[model samples]
Target: MAGLISKVFKAKWLLLGIALVLLLVWILRPFLDVFVYGIFVYYITRPIKQWLSRYIKNEGILVSVSLLMLALPLIILIAYTLLVGMSQLMAVVNSYGLTAALPSGPLTNMTTSFSQLHSNLTSGNFTLESVTDITRQDWYKTISGYSGNLPLLQAIAFSTGSTIVDIAFKLFIIFLVGFYMLKEDAHMQRWFAGTFPKLMDEHNRLLPRYASAVDADLQKLFFGNLLSIVFFAIIAAVVFEGLSIFAPVPSLQIPSPILLGILCGVSALIPIVGMWLVAGPLFLYLLISSLIAGTLFTHFGYFLFMVLAIFVFVLTIPSFVIQPFMARGQVHSGLLMFAYVLGPLVFGISGLFLGAIVLVLVTHYFGIVVPEMAAEGQESHDFDL
Candidate 1:
């Protein structure tokens, strides 16, 4: 009877503890992005902290220098890139007269083209070959006169301003939270480990190990991503600049090579889409412009094709070669791909990190921890019997 009462009391306390944890998670839900960003900053700068610790020995000073060396430069670079890219984008819009290109002009041209085709068909002069030729010529003519409307430009400008403000705020929060996390990393770890019930020896041992595994995975994901971004950015800039300088015609040039290159690097983070998000629009523009200007089949067209081929190759290498090599024994490529793609869909931008954390925890528990716990449980059960 006494044993039963004791068991009931313990179960009630366990339930209460779980409730408290759930409550804490609820409270922290809104700031999940901040914490996730902080963790990323923590892992990325951890090596620097350790290296500097050898000489400095003061944790605060070590963390401060590491943050300044890594985080500050990174933040500044990102800000500068964003500002330059926006200016470049606006320039491209103005140069292409995108702000003046209305659907009405294109639609009217398309309607005229179709009317002519219909007249030819009804006049008993239509053949498949003629129809195709006429259609192609009409499209070229229509695209040549393209100019974006004012309303669209106004919308784009408004959205761009709002997006810039939002990104700036988020970045500020990320850096602010990250600074403290880097400084008190040791204390944070101790606090986390100490959160579990002291009586549960298994949990106390397993929790830290699990955390270490997660940390290692986060390091691979973030550092690999950063390296890929830098590599792709450099490659893209060189390729675009080379084409711009040597292309046979000025019409074949890529507008704002730096902006396009940075966008290409940013696109590397998205799984299957990759750099095509930047390359696709650029290629389409070049193709249309070349066709309209009767530059197709010329040296300019050849150079444009070369640019496309090179960009495709660059995009392919990361997915097929670099990523596989980087993730070789750490995490499965398929799982990482899923996390990269689905994370943003489910958890917004921060999902990339959050999804990875969940993946690591789930995989660790099922692949390693669960089995060990089960084996121990079986042994204990046999001993009791």
Candidate 2:
């Protein structure tokens, strides 16, 4: 009885110590994220660091050179893409006369048909003048609502600034971690191997295999996705220009090649619907413009179908076909369906990385524990019999 009591008291103290440590970690969680994100960045750039190190024969010089080399290309590409998108947006706004309330040009064709159909059915005159008044009133209301959101806009700006600072700090941490990880790569491996006395040989043997698996899977998913986005953007641009569907719509005057390409590329990351995310507002623009021209009733149905089809193809196809295959291939930690779903829910956007690590550790721990439990249960049953 005394021995059992002593063991229980020891366990209680151990649990208390662990709880204190966890509490400290939780409090420091936000700062830790900056370090954690840096680790992921290190993982992504490790190969480049190695290759550069070989050429320079100095780890420090190699890391510095590789970072500069990577940064220049990334900055140039992002700047060019953003400039192209913004210039196209400004051109579209300018071409529409900025504040002109009436729908004009090829867009007038749909309005003309709608007025005739409405007059035929209602036995009342449906004039373009009345339609125009209603539309201008609605636009005024929308503008007023946006004007009321000035305070919200300021809050958003402040939040954005803080977020940028956090990201910058994290990126710096990532570079530091990457440099040291590259410099002392052998020391890290040796430390890991020496820590596990019982399974030192097996653990050392499998460490490289595990690391390689993670590296291969993550690189394939990330790089393949980057390529896919660029490809899809180019395709969207070509399709928009060739179709000229937006040519008739005043809401979209941007050169179809540049504007549509960028929208398709960036929005493609949104889980379910990619380019279709923008299609709804665009369709509404056409609808409102036609209404003001007194011809919305006639060609509305046809216009609706065309917009729907474009959105469905742009948004749905990639998500259903591409995403699942990549996810299954990369996340091979034998996580069950529940963990797979809930992992992201608990982890935020960073959940994909953290969740995979947690899942792998949990699985390994259980793999050891469950068999021992089973074996003990069987032995007890035999003794009882």
Highest TM-score: which candidate? 1
Candidate 2, pairs of clashing residues: 38-174, 111-295, 114-295, 115-294
Model 1 per-residue lDDT tens digits across residues 49-130 = 8788889887778888988888767646644444444445445655678745422322222222333333334455334665
Local distance difference test, each candidate: 0.64, 0.52
Error of 1 at 153 (Å): 12
Which residue pairs does candidate 1 place in steric collision?
99-148, 100-147, 100-148, 101-147, 101-148, 101-149
Please give the lDDT score at residue 285 for candidate 2: 63
Backbone clashes in candidate 1 total: 6
TM for candidate 2 is 0.45
Clashes of each: 6, 4
- Tens digits of per-residue lDDT for model 2, 179-245: 6765676788788767754554453344445555555554443334433454456556655555455
Q: Quick one: best lDDT, which candidate?
A: 1
Using all chains and alpha carbons, the TM-scores for the candidates as numbered come to 0.57, 0.45
Report the lDDT of model 1 for residue 81.
46
Model 1 segments more than 4 A misplaced: 1-19, 54-57, 72-173, 191-200, 226-297, 300-329, 377-385
Stretches of candidate 2 exceeding 4 Å from the true structure: 1-24, 71-154, 157-168, 202-212, 223-385
